[model samples]
Target chain A: MKEETIINFTHHQTAHCENGVVSNLMKHNGFSVSEPMVFGIGSGLLFCYIPFLKVNHAPVITYRAMPGHIFKKFAKRTGIKMKREKFSNPKEAQSKLDENLERNNPVGLQVGVYNLLYFPDEYRFHFNAHNMVVYGKQDGRYLISDPVMEEVTSLSEKELEKVRFAKGAFAPKGHMYYPISFPEKLELEKAIVSGIKDTCKTMLAPIPIVGVKGIKTIANLIRKWPKKKGIKTANHYLGQVVRMQEEIGTGGGGFRYIYAAFLQESGKLIGNEKLIELAKEMTEIGDLWRDFAVEASRIYKNRSRNDAGQSENYNQVANQLDHIADLEKVFFKKLKKAI
Target chain B: MKKEEVPQDKSNLESANFRELCYAIDENGEYTTANSTGWEPKTVALNNAIDEINDRIEDAKKRVLEGKTSPIEYHMELHKMDVGILASYVGLWQWRVKRHFKPSVFKKLKMNTLQKYAEVFEISVDELKTIK
Candidate 1:
């Protein structure tokens, strides 16, 4: 029997793929940072319900920032350096990855979420920007640490290449990244303050596409959907909203809970009790988001629940979201003063 | 959002094929974690996506039977794609993919092109040529 050939890599199942990949990469470089800390330093918390933009013919609603932005922000905040490369040709990309693996380098890659065969069919979509680490090759299959998976998995070279070069909607173009260096020690004081301010700016942005206003916009959109698209079609939209929020990439309550964990960790790192209290408030806000998902899902389940009851459910969701928005608003404001 | 309403069915949570742990608040507003088997709210999302693909497949099958479109069309819809998306995956242009959607063009397509589409759908070319 052929023996297994996996580079020394620790697999950690994290709430978000980008956070997990970045954290794992840092750990590979001897920097011990938690997933939540990576997420926070990257400033992964934000909201935008852009009706103008569409994915798979539906309006786009992103709970987190754009792909690769978080990793860039994290590196900017912490003094870590990484080498990221994208290949135009799949053959060259394959050779580069093989060369890296031959040197025992565990490389991170960008892949489409849909073509990953190991993923449940129900969970697959046309999303083309999922992140994972490729650590080894054995018998023409690649060992992978997909942060969203419960365990490390392996895929054939053909399967990996298909996902890596998946077309349409944020094509990865064979992108790969790994840290080149890490500072002797991480002084998170400046990084924490900067991350908090970054989040605050996103939350407070007056543009209609994002932040508190975006929540209100989505609520209003959901309220009108039942009337606009009819109950059945509207239910599909609602299902997709929560799916984007929670289903894709360990999303539970739109990463609000993850952000809370970051705040708690950051609080401890800075030794500020008030930040920890703020973390509690953020957790409560995360619950409010989950509450919206539950009520919205209930509405989706009840197709014939009548317009009045349906309207009431949507109103409750909108009201809860608004409440959550207010809480985050205050939370960021207080966070600014806290630090 | 009443914390009480959050599910706590230990059996279901444990028996679920794939469960995820999400950091959440407990009933006491404490920072307690929850083990979600992705059973409740996520099921609604999962079922909806499945239904959408099934509906598309049904429509594509109907079109293929009526000779209005080719199996390539059905296969594309089965994979939940449009002309532009398929074009990108197959390294073809949008106009060409639109042309290939016709039964006449798809029937005359060379083995190389058919192989590309087959690899995308992860099926044999014979399967791609014939309706299942």
Candidate 2:
């Protein structure tokens, strides 16, 4: 009976609410746990738990990459051509600038030169590259100005002068252009990190219910008891479920509704035998969810470390998450029989 | 056709010469070789000519260091003047030391030293090949 309580507690509504607590824990640990957690929870439920519940729903996955052809109309509307060039040394890649400058020269006659430095490479793509200076020839001598000076104009002459006079001043500036402003870089970095955080938050959305499989398992065990004790034990399990639902609702109202629906639908089935089986199946599903959440949390930690520039441990953590997902699929097959 | 016309033409020439002299003085701190190479008068004048050319080269070098004149400018200026020719001449004077020297050697030296300068001038290595 005690073991059933533990299992039911682990597999009930309150388990999902633990995500908020974990998020606060992440904050306390000084790591931005927002994105990976969301992605983990949302993806975990979609890929792991939804099939267990026999819910016919499809999950949408979004990632950062080049836009699809549907965006071609928007591209024409914006009149912006996104083309990129690669150079070993950004400063040494004179031909690229010369070619671009020549193409833009006719337009420059009216609007000034727009010799923007572009980072077309995936690794070097950054917003800061918009502030770098572009150098070219006017008449028969050298000329220099901000590459994206037309777009962002806060770059001061003094800053340009300082860059012009720096050591190895003749060395070709690299293709990875960064804005002259540190504040801009910081802001851009934060936005990028925030996007990743949001994704994590979405992934972890189903965790509260998944976290409390113990209560569900206990409910099943109580239903299996002698008729005299069964009512009392079942009432205790009901009380636990209600409490778990309340906790989950307090943290995030979404899981509360989900749990309530699960209870309402399962309650309509006749006989204690069917109820016991449903509880048992839910308990198993809850355990898988808990395992998935733990693994997802671990993966998030590793991904956060990777974002912090630690690549060595990232692969190992990713592999572990893959293994956990595979395990969930197996459990999902078993839970589907109950449905 | 008159005496006045002759004096006017002579004055025009003199003014042009004076302007050239002033430019040289401002640029090289000497006036003797302002109009043309002051090499025919004597060894002192010939030495002064060399000194003035060297002064111009030194100024160009300083500008390169200061990121003012780019490598393309330096290479182009080298083509416009007789500095490389003079350096080759001096190298020939020490034939024993310069016997193994070749045009390729000079090219390699130029590329290695002036590559950074060319980058500053926004001239690619491929473009630098077309300069000569």
lDDT of 2 by residue, A1-339 (tens): 011111000111112222222222223223333312322222222311221221001111111111122122212222223233334543444444455445432101001011212211111111111222233344332243222111212222333332322222122232322111112111222232233233234333345222123223222332342243333232222222222222111111113222222322333322224423443343334333333333323322221122322232233333433444444344444333433
Clashes of 2: 45
What's the lDDT for residue A48 in model 1? 90
Model 1 alpha-carbon drift over 4 Å, by segment: A1-5, A248-251, A303-308, B1-16, B25-34, B102-115, B124-126
How close is each model in CA RMSD to the real structure? 3.1, 34.4
The prediction achieving the highest lDDT against the true structure is 1
Tell me the spans in candidate 2 whose CA falls farther than 4 Å from its real position: A1-45, A48-268, A272-275, A291-336, B1-132
- What is the model-wide C-alpha lDDT for candidate 1? 0.80
CAPRI band for model 1:
acceptable
Q: List the residue pairs that clash in candidate 1.
A: none
Number of the top candidate by DockQ?
1
Winning model by TM-score: 1
TM-scores for the candidates:
0.90, 0.18
lDDT digits (tens) for residues A33-66 of candidate 1: 8888888888888899876566655677988888
Candidate 2 CAPRI category: incorrect
Each prediction's DockQ?
0.42, 0.01
